[model samples]
Target: MTQNLYIPASTGGTLMSNMPLITSIEELTAEVITDLLQAAGSLTESQHVTAVEPVSFGDQSGLLSYLYRVGLTYSDGAQGPATVVVKLPTDDPNQRGISDALGFYNRECTYYNVVAPTAPFKTATIFGQAQATDSTDFIIVMEDLGHMERIDQVIGATLPEIETVLKALAKLHAVYWGHQDLENLSSTFLPMDNPIYHAALPGIFGAGWASLKVNAPDLLDPEIIEFGDNYSTHLPQMLAALNTPTTLLHGDYRADNLLLDEEGNLAVIDFQITSMGNCAFDIAYFLSSSVTSETRAAHADQLLHLYHDTLTAEGVNYSFEDLEAGFRVALAFCLIYGVASFAGWDSFGERQQELMRSMASRTIYSILETNALDSLNAN
Candidate 1:
C-alpha cells in the first residue's frame, strides 16, 4: 500500500496526487513528467509529455539539493512551458547526511505540500512534491522563475525594493500572527530548540567561524566572534523572545531568494529553512544580509516602521516599540548564517563571496548598533 502524504487540502489549491518521490533528474521519464503535470491540474487527460530536456540552473552551491531547468514539449504538437525548475537531493554523502540530520529536506517538502498554499505572498507554484519516509530522498517540481530578474545580494537592493519586501513580509506576518494552528504543524515545522538544530549548531558555527577567520578575516570582528562563542548560553532568553506571539517565518529571506518581475512584484523561493519564529528574525535577516551597510544605515528604521504600520493596519496588536526590540534581538540570531556562509565560502563564486562578506560585516554592525549582545546577556 502507498503511504499517504500528509498534505492538508483546506487551503484550496491543486494538491499533489500520486506523485512518486524522485531522487534525481535522470529518473524523470516522459511518463513521469506527464503524470506530474496531470496531478497539478496543468494538463488534461488528452495531453501528454512528448519530450524533456534538463539543464543545470543557477549556481550549483546548494549544499542539500541539485537544481535543474527542464524544457518540455506536448504530444499534440503543442508547446508547453519552455522550462520548469526541479529540485532534487544532492548525491554527496556528507552533505546529504548533514541535510537529513538537520531535517532541511523534510521542512522544504512540507512547506510546498502544505504551508505555501496558505501564505499571503507569492511563492513558486508546486507542480509536484514528494519525499521518502526517511527524508533522504525528495523532489519538488515548481514553476520556473528564470525569466524574472533576481536581486543581487552583493549589489544590494534599492530603497523602493526594500520597502516592497517589507510590505510582503508584513502581510505574511499579519496573516499568521498569533495563530494557534502553528502548534498543530509541529512535526513538520520545528521550533528553534529542535534537537536537530541543537545537534547541528556547534559544527555549523565552528566551521563558519573557522572559514570566516581564514577566508575573509576582515569581516570577522573580535567582538563578533566572541559574541558568537557565547551565544548558546543565551538560548533560553532568545527562545522566550522568539515565542512572543509567534508567526510563520521565511527563514532565509534574502535578496537572492527573491525574484522580481518587470513591475517589481516579488515571488520567493527556497523554503528549506522555513519555520515558526518571531517575524522580527525575517525582517532583521533581510536588512542585514540583503542590503549594504550604507543602505541599512540610511533606511533601516524607516523600513522597520513601515513593517509595524502595515501590521497595525492589518489589526495586529503588536506595537512599534516591541517590534523594534524584537528586531534588535533578532540581529544576533542572524549571525548564525553570517558565520556559516563564511565557512562555506569556497562553495560560492567570487560574486557570492563578496555577498557573504558584506552580509557578515553588516550583521556584526547591526548587532553592535542595537547592543544585541548586551540584551542577550541581561537577565
Candidate 2:
C-alpha cells in the first residue's frame, strides 16, 4: 500500500533539516518528498515528485546501514535527479547495537550536515537528512553515484587507484592538520582517544574473535589468536599513540567506499566511522585492507613516499620517518576491523565474506611485512 501524505514543508524542520522526517521507507511518499525537495529549493513550485521506486541493497553494500537506491519520477517534463540513495539504520540488532554505542548514526549525519560540504575531496551531495537524538533512528537522502566506477575490494585495487585515493587523503589531512577548530569539532566528531570507544571496542573486538573461532577458524592461526587475545590489554596504549598528529580520518577508508567518475573526480562515501586521529590510520587501513598484498609489497615504499611528498608540498612539515612509524602503528590497529567482521559472519553473504577474507589476508600480510606489531611496543 502506498501512502499519500500531503503535509507542507514548513511543518518539517526539526533541527536536522527542513526535510520531512521519515523513520521508515514507507513514509517516503511522493507528496512528502515533493514538499521536502521544495523546501530545499531543489524543485520549482510548479514541479512535484510523481513516483518512487526503491530497491534495497544487500549486506555487501554496507553492514551498518540499510541502503536503498530510489528511482524517482517528476510531474511532467520537470528536470531533477533521476535517482537518489537513502541510508537508514541497519535492522540487524547486533550491528545496530554497535552503531548506537559508538555514535555511528550521529557521526554520519553530522558528516553529511557539516563536514561533507567543505571536505577537500568529493562526497555525495546531500538532498536531506534527519537524525533522532535517541541515536537509533536516522535517514539520509543523497545523490546516487552508482554510475561511477568502484574498485572491487575482494579482487583488490590497482596501484593507480590506490595512489589516487592516497593523494586525496593527503590533501584532506593537510587541510585539517592541527587546525584551530579541531576542539570545536570534537563535540560531534569524537577524538580517537574518546573514552566511550576505549570502553566499548575491546568487547566488540573480543566478540569478533570468539565468533571467528567458530565460523572461520582457518583465518586465525595460533599466533594471530594470541595477538587477538591480548589486543584489549594493549588497546589503550595503542589509541594513545594514534591520537597525536590529529586530523580528520575517514575512519573506514578503502576501495569499497571510493568511487571515481569519468572525469577522474573521486568521491568518498560511508562516513559512518569518521573520526579525529592521526591521518596515518586512514592511509594504513587503505593500503593494508583495500589493495592486494602483492601490490602493497611491491609499491609500499613508493606509495608511502608519495603520500609524504604530497603532504610536504602542501606545507605540512611531518617527516617521512615519523609518518612511516605512524603508518606501522595504524597497521597494527587495522586488525580490529578484520577480526570484527566475523562477529556477524553468518549474516554476511558470500560476496561480503569473500571481501572480508581478502581484507583479513591483506591486513595480516601488511602487518607481518612491516613488522607493525613491533611498533605497538616501540618506545
lDDT of each: 0.77, 0.82
TM-score of each: 0.90, 0.93
Residue 362 in model 1: lDDT: 84
Q: How close is candidate 2 to the true structure, as a TM-score?
A: 0.93
Encode model 1's per-residue lDDT on 27-146: one tens digit a residue: 887788888787777787778898889998666662568899998988875445767899988775556766777677777877777777777677887887776654467778889998
lDDT of 1: 0.77
51: Cα error in model 1, Å: 1.6
The per-residue C-alpha lDDT of model 1 at residue 286 equals: 96
Model 1 spans with C-alpha error above 4 angstroms? 1-17, 92-95
